[model samples]
Target chain A: MKKIIIASTSAMYGGKYLEYLQPVLQEHFKDCSSLVFIPYARPGGITHEAYTAKVAETFTAIGINVKGLHEFDNPAQAVLDAEALFTGGGNTFLLVNELYNTGVMQALEKAVHAGTPYLGSSAGSNICGLTMQTTNDMPIIYPPSFKTLGVVPFNINPHYLDPVEGSTHMGETRETRIREFHVFHRQPVVGLREGSWLEVKGSAIVLGGDRHARIFRQGQEPEEVAPGADLSGLK
Target chain B: MKKIIIASTSAMYGGKYLEYLQPVLQEHFKDCSSLVFIPYARPGGITHEAYTAKVAETFTAIGINVKGLHEFDNPAQAVLDAEALFTGGGNTFLLVNELYNTGVMQALEKAVHAGTPYLGSSAGSNICGLTMQTTNDMPIIYPPSFKTLGVVPFNINPHYLDPVEGSTHMGETRETRIREFHVFHRQPVVGLREGSWLEVKGSAIVLGGDRHARIFRQGQEPEEVAPGADLSGLK
Candidate 1:
């Protein structure tokens, strides 16, 4: 059975790091005393140790011990032995590249599937999808492949934003970019806005948080589903 | 002498396609009667023919004939023989993938270096840089490499935008993304704002339009350069 929480972001505007998800994480990892943290995504290019320490500070309040995967000599073995797991978010390209380079992407995926309580935020949540094709991050580095965990049936567009009603910026909006992804892919995409997440237990996946998630399926109009809605049928 | 016009966008907010660039393009390609357009980017996932037709409509008004590179049986040969070239904006990954798939990336680069008049907008302009790693487009498809034409010494972040003063979105801002790019790359980057362009005439590259361009160099603070400023010293 898989127990996972894939969140849109670790922090909300005007909030401290992981401030909003702390409560959910407490319950999610209640059965575990400590967890291994994968901090390779290093937001703003922070060092892995620094990023892990920041996550540790937050988990300390929840009575959970945190150790960065980088701190271990055998990261894949550490992931396999973790009581719980958390992957922080930053550059998806960097995350995927480092995961491949460290030979732990598959180990992490297997651990999550083997009933490890797993938490992912932003770029971390993105890898839980079918592919990283829909990520909003710049291609800071080239990964060996775009394939990801596929723990979730569909892809994720974390921190997904709606088009500004009257904006003049000519760049592609989040929706436009996802639609373009559909041009080359058939996977459904979940536009997970801030404050939203997918809660998975065993084979059941449900939407959590107060906001509505925008679901995008190829050849179908995008629809909004409220929190607590079942998302197991996304595929 | 190499001659190129790398623009931030093909269309500005609420403006007709290529309307803002007609006057400048009239002089840029004054010696050419026809130009080949690469519609591989295909913004909004429009068909190559449709995208080309839209561009042809604009160039028609400027007294130049337009033909899509897709219409040619041998794209590489067409690029080598083109009187002038224009690559429209779309997904950077798709454009780069198609350029490599059809074996035209190198030919296009050679043609541009051989002094063929070249015009690029958005994703097209992105390829004029050292690499496509700084592109804002979604990775709809994987390309063989992030390396690009290197016609310019630096990378380009086209359709560059400033952070919203009061927005609550937690996703990385345009500046943050570029800053992250600098972590792994030493090349300078130009954040080309909408309506701004880079006009290259032989060894001289100058910023065009009224807006200032944000320049990002490794290990240094970002600086703003006014229009008409020489950018040949970026490297």
Candidate 2:
């Protein structure tokens, strides 16, 4: 059984981000002895060494014994040594490129299916989906293809929101974007809002977050998903 | 010489939306003789009768001959007759899905290449790309595929924006999303800020708006594009 814990933050060590999320991460990986952190998305320049280092320090203080995988450029070896893999979020494109280039994404998929604990945050959480179709970023550079790491069956929309009032931006609203997503992707999107998370343990799915996720199937009005709801219904 | 004018709104007559985009529409298509509105996206949700009289009234009041082409269910004829086609903004998924399902996307593509003067707004602009890879919507639903009416060589990030100061929203910022778009799409994205537009006349690409549209390319810093600037440099 693959125990996947997709969070929204890196470790705090002595800091706090989404303070509500810390307990959930700790409780989810209580049994794991060590957690491996992969921080490769800094390439797009959204992430910095200071934040990554802080993540390392935070995990170590919590006794998670976290190590940065950038040290082991070898893709196969990184997977072989990791007990529980934790991927911190940065830019999904940067992370996806590194994983595809290094073959670490395929390796992690193998390890996850083989019952190794896998942890992911924002960009990390996005890679868990069938495609990175729900990412809210622009394509600044070019790669071989637009496909993403297909670690999960559904699409993941991080920081999903309903439209806010008095907005004059010419782009479609958040709801409209989701509706468009429903029209493009054959799969359902797990609209994971900030401060919320989804945990999968031994085939059991649990939703954890402040706001319930919004799931939209084709041709249906979007429905609200509360915490502790089962995602199998979405599947 | 295809003259495609992608506007910011359509005549959503009977709804409170027509007044919202009237001035912009008037200024853009003031001299255009004819216009064809597409409701193919609504499928069964909207009937032909429901959209025609309403859209016709508002557009005709502006002195432009408006024709809602629900009668020509045939995609080929629809593309052949419409000299100036203006695809309105709606759910892009539904729009692209119907276009693909009825095989109208290619028909539209043919007309565009033949210089039929295609004018698209939101969803309309999206269809002009290699693929709708840079859209800022959820990926919940899937169509026949992720294919679009490849009019423009690149993708369009509709309703694009700069990051708001002290905004609590968490996700990739506008700048980052465009950068991620670069990773997969080597073709530069014409980040059309809301109320912003690009008019292609003969070979002159004119940026029309009060903002700078960024051109995202791989291995390079994105360049800010201004109105009346020669876009040949982008190509």
Candidate 3:
């Protein structure tokens, strides 16, 4: 069975990195000894080694060993051999570019489909959707294609934010951007706010965390799905 | 003489559509009786005719007639024949896709380079840069290329905003996104705030409006250029 945790963000308000998700992660990785970390996203232009170490600092506390995919001679083979997998957040464009160029996107999809435990946050979580069309990241780089692993039926709009009342900023709101996405795309979009995550097991995808997630289907009104709600219905 | 007005937004805070810009636009389009308006961006999923009418209302007030490119059978030919041009803000990807698909990107570039008076706001202004890589719009559709008109020496990050103090939003700040862009591309970027604009005349590009603009250059600290400052030196 496929087991995965797709989070909107790695940290919550007033919290250290992954601190709020520690309890859930502890149980999530209980069966794994070590997992391969894909640090290709490199948030804030961080190097591969530095990003990997940052992730290791947190995973080590949960009694899990972390190995970066870059350490291996063959990244695709490493994904196939990993007992579990974790992909951190960063620029989605850069992440997708590296995944496609390194040929790890296909291999990683196969590993996850084969029931390897997986964890993803931000740009990492976005790849679980139909496409990267709804990502908030700038186009720092262009990927071979916007295609991603459709592990879930819908696209994940991570770090989803609500419109600020009386704000002077005129940029498109997160909701407006998602609505525009529906103009050209037919897939359903889940607005995953901070502190929220999707727990996928087998064919069941449940909403985790305390807040409700916003669900948007093409040509339909957006609705809020409560915490612990089964999102597999969206499929 | 390469006359152009690149605005951060079509509408400013508490102001009517193109209100603050009318004074400058009146002079910008003084010589032309009518101009071609590109509504390919289609903000908020508005139809081309509807968006064009929106621009037409504002231009008409300034004694300049507006004509949407879509009304013409040949968009490329219309661009070449335009006395002046105005491209409204909307989804950048959609606008870029339409421009490329219709083969008007080249024609528009040619027209602009030949000194046809041009005005662009938001996504429209974004394309006046070297590429649309710095755009803030969602990737609703894939464009044939991120490349755009190099009318200006660098890229423009329209609707640029600063990080809110004490805010907990985990999304990358506007500044952070531009810095990440420098990691792969070596081009200067100007963060134009709402109400601010760039006045490009011949070889000089001057900052206008009431606020300062942020400048990001590769391998250097970001600097703020005051309003009315001539930015031709950076070029």
Candidate 4:
């Protein structure tokens, strides 16, 4: 059984990491020993120690032990030590590039499939797909260009949002992005909103968030669905 | 000889079509009686007649009579009737969508390889590459998800430009788009600037334009290049 909780980001507006992790932090890690972070994506480009310390601060605030992945050097052993793993957000492109370059992507995917509880936000949520083609932003950063973890068959369009009124940027709207995706593909994309998330436990998929999920299939209007609902559209 | 000209647009900014057909254009079309116009892409959502007629107006101005594919019910006859083919610009996604839907892409590819002179602008130029993954506007209007004409091994990011300063929108920049493309695959992308184009006659491949061309190989800065330039970078 696969166990993963992929989220949009670790913050809602100005909310801290704890705010975003509140719902899942305790429930998924009641028996976990430590938290390891992969923070190669800071705008300032933080060191692994500093990035992990930040996560440690958040974990300590909630009375849990935490560490950064860099400390161990052996990423596979680091994964072995953790009962659960938490990946923070920065730029999706930046995060994915580092993961590919350092071979952390393969390690993380192996660990998660081996029963480690995987938690990710924003860019971190993005790497869980078969390809990064569905990302909402431009696929700008390139680091070795390896395929992603392949957790799901479809692409992810992260930070998915409705277009602002009367914009002049000359790009397609979110709906069009999804539709264009359909042209290249035949799979259904779960247009996860800002607060929405996908929770995978064993073989079951559950959605949790404040708003309804928008599911887009080929040749149809995207429909809205709620938490715990069966994704008949997905199949 | 496979005669191909990848242009920036059917009509460049502030310029009429065929008004600027240069030594290269004349070199490709010794006789231009049967010209094919593929106008499936409409960012402005213009009709096939309107877009195709606009292309014909340009060729006729140059004393080369042209006909749109829509003038005939069957597109194969349209392909067969052409001494030369000119695909106009609007939206690469829409253009390719219509081509794939109508099965004109395969016909055009066959015609070009069969020795017909092929001329294209903007969206038309984009279709020459392996995929429409890097076109300028978001394929928000339609899916450009065709196998494409495949004259070039790479993708074409048309109307390529750097971002303006003080912009509020946080979407990915043009450079970012190219990099994002590299993340998924190892193909080089031709960042054909507005004035830049490609002229293909038999074994000769020429990059024709005013500005320096930008080519992105995986994990490197986009290298600057020029017209009649060698594109071993593309392979």
Best by TM-score: 1
Q: Which ten residues in a row have the lowest lDDT in candidate 2 chain B?
A: B7-16
| CAPRI tier of model 2 | acceptable
Q: Judged by DockQ relative to the true structure, which candidate is superior, 1 or 4?
A: 1
Q: Per-candidate TM vs. native?
A: 0.99, 0.73, 0.99, 0.57
Angstrom error of the Cα, residue A145, model 4: value is 5.3
Candidate 2 residues A83-170, lDDT tens each? 8787777766567767788878778888888878887878788888877767655333223344665556677777776676666564
Give one digit per residue, the lDDT tens place, for model 1 in B141-231. 9999999999999999999999998999999999999999999999999999999999999999999999999999998999999999999
The DockQ leader among the candidates is: 1
lDDT of 4 by residue, B1-235 (tens): 7888887654455555555555567667767655677766653556778876776676665567766777778886578557888787765656776788777888888888888888877778888888766666443333435457887777777667766566533344577757756755677888777667877767666788777778888877888887669663466
User: What is the lDDT, from 0 to 100, of the residue A175 in candidate 2?
Assistant: 64
TM-score ranking from best to worst? 1, 3, 2, 4
Q: Report iRMS values in order.
A: 0.6, 6.0, 0.9, 7.2
Alpha-carbon lDDT, every model: 0.95, 0.67, 0.93, 0.69
Tens-digit lDDT track of model 3 for A1-235: 8999999999988888899999989888899989899999888899999999989999998889999999999999999999999999999999999999999999989999999999999999999998988999999887889999889988999999999878999888999999989988899999999999999999999999999999999999999999999988895
Worst 10 residues of 1 chain A by lDDT: A18-27
Q: Candidate 3 DockQ category?
A: high
Interface RMSD of 3: 0.9
Question: Candidate 4: where are CA atoms >4 Å away?
Answer: A41-50, A91-94, A143-146, B1-235
Docking class of 4: incorrect
Instruction: Find the 10 residues in a row with the least total lDDT in model 1 chain B.
Output: B54-63
Per-candidate clashes, comma-separated: 0, 28, 0, 12
